[model samples]
Target: MLIDEMLHLFYPRVCTGCHSLLAPKERGICPECIASFDAFSDADAAGYAVKEVFRRNYPASNQPESAWTLYRFHKNDRLQRVVHAMKYEGVHRLGNVFGTLLAEMIAGSTAAAAFSCIVPVPLNRLKVVERTYNQSEVIARAVAGVLRKDVCTDLVVCKNHTRPQAGLSLRERHSNVKDAFTPSGNVVPENILLVDDVLTTGSTATAVMRALESAGARQISLATVVLAA
Candidate 1:
């Protein structure tokens, strides 16, 4: 505890959202910034959104059981600022903090408890290299820490690196990640919670979902740091 306090004294951390000094209890964003987040965080609503993404991918397939996100994504907003820190500004620990909080929302719920394993959406090799870490994996581990579940990183692998999904039309986004992911041959077919940093169009998430399903996953749930409209 003393070491931690000294470290904080030497390298104070700032909230990603407002660039304010983070208090001792805060990890990524401050309490005021957190309270300022737009509140569409209902689990039921997120579950519906998850099912909707599944339907878009496989209209006839069994829909996902639960989907949960902590905040609504708005361009140039607080959520976006935190996302930028995790994805671009090299503050990857923000994902860990948020993922733990994300899991806490549904901790004991049946839908959350049913998952046999947590799988982070695999990043392409190039992106992992550029980012220095897989933000999704960092998030997934934090969630696993809270949920007491195993995080399986190898269940899915990125097969191809494509153009960034940002600014792409829906169709273009889908095309970009089409065939971008493949499940490892040793899939367990267990109930799995797929974790990601953000769900924009969900093209990437849906593609990975298809791969997981193809690999014989029994049931799937979706969790993200934020739900992008």
Candidate 2:
């Protein structure tokens, strides 16, 4: 504890969202910035937006039993800043923090106690080299810690590099991610939760889901930190 305090004195913790110095109790983020996030409750408009994305994009036959996201991701907004920091600014621990919180939500939802394993949407080899880590895997591991489930990093692999899904039309996004992922090896679980940083058009998640299904996964659900609004 003394060493932590000493480190804080030299390099104080800062909120990923607002870049404000954090108090002692705060770790990666300050309370004010955390409170400012537009959380997605089941009744909220943004929550429904996520469902719409799945409805429009995910195949009916392969639809997940449940899905949940923590925040509404608006461009240039507080959530966007938080995501940017986690993805590009090397605030990697933010993924674990958000994932732990997401696990709490999942524990209370219809999807509670359903997953046997957590599978993060994998990054292609090139992107992994650039990012140095798959942000989704970081989140998935934290979630697994809370849920007591194993994180299957090798089950699904993103073999093909694709263009970024951002700024693309729904059709283009689908085309970009199609056949980009493949399931490898054995050890398929009966139920698994797919983890990702955000849900946009659902194209990427859908592709991942299809690969899991093809690999003999019987039940698959999804959890993410933000749903694009």
Candidate 3:
């Protein structure tokens, strides 16, 4: 304990959100910063507002029946700082923290009981090569641990590197990710909980879910750490 304290004196850690010096037990963002995040659902549950997200962005036939996102992501906010740190700044552990928080909100929900397995949305090969990790996979693993469900990491994969969906129109976004993902094998899943870092237009998620459906995924639900408006 003394040695750890001395090392911290020389090299202090800081919160990602506020950039304040961190206590030993604290991880990426401080508790206050997490509390300050704007939530889509105020009821402290993994609310169903993402259902509307799916309805608005996805084709009626391809819409994800249910979905959940932890934080409402906005520009230049604490949640954004946390996301940038997790996604780009190499603070990979933040994904686990957010996933755990998400699981807490989802533990007793219908989605928790309905999902037979968890599958993280696969990352582009280039991003994985650059980051050396998949943030969504880390999030899925943590969620699976809490939910006591199996995680299927090998079933779905990106078949092509699609263009970035940022700044694209809804039609363009759908066209970009279409046919980008495909199932890897014939094994079927009863109910899949698809996990990802963030949700924007739902185009990417829709494409992946369609692939899973083609591969015999019975019913698919979406889970994300952040929802970008």
TM-score of each prediction: 0.93, 0.93, 0.91
lDDT of 2 by residue, 33-133 (tens): 77888886552344466667887776464776577788887678887878877886678878988999888877776665778889999999898888888
Candidate 2 vs candidate 3, TM-score winner: 2
lDDT of 1 by residue, 77-152 (tens): 8778778788877786688778888888769578877889999999999998987888999999999999999999
**What is the lDDT for 175 in model 1?**
91
Model 1 backbone overlap count:
0
**Model 2 misplacement above 4 A:** 42-49, 59-61
Tens-digit lDDT track of model 3 for 187-225: 968788999898888888888898899989878878888
Q: Which stretches of candidate 1 lie over 4 Å from their true place?
A: 53-62
How many clashes show up per model? 0, 0, 0
lDDT of 1 at 213: 89
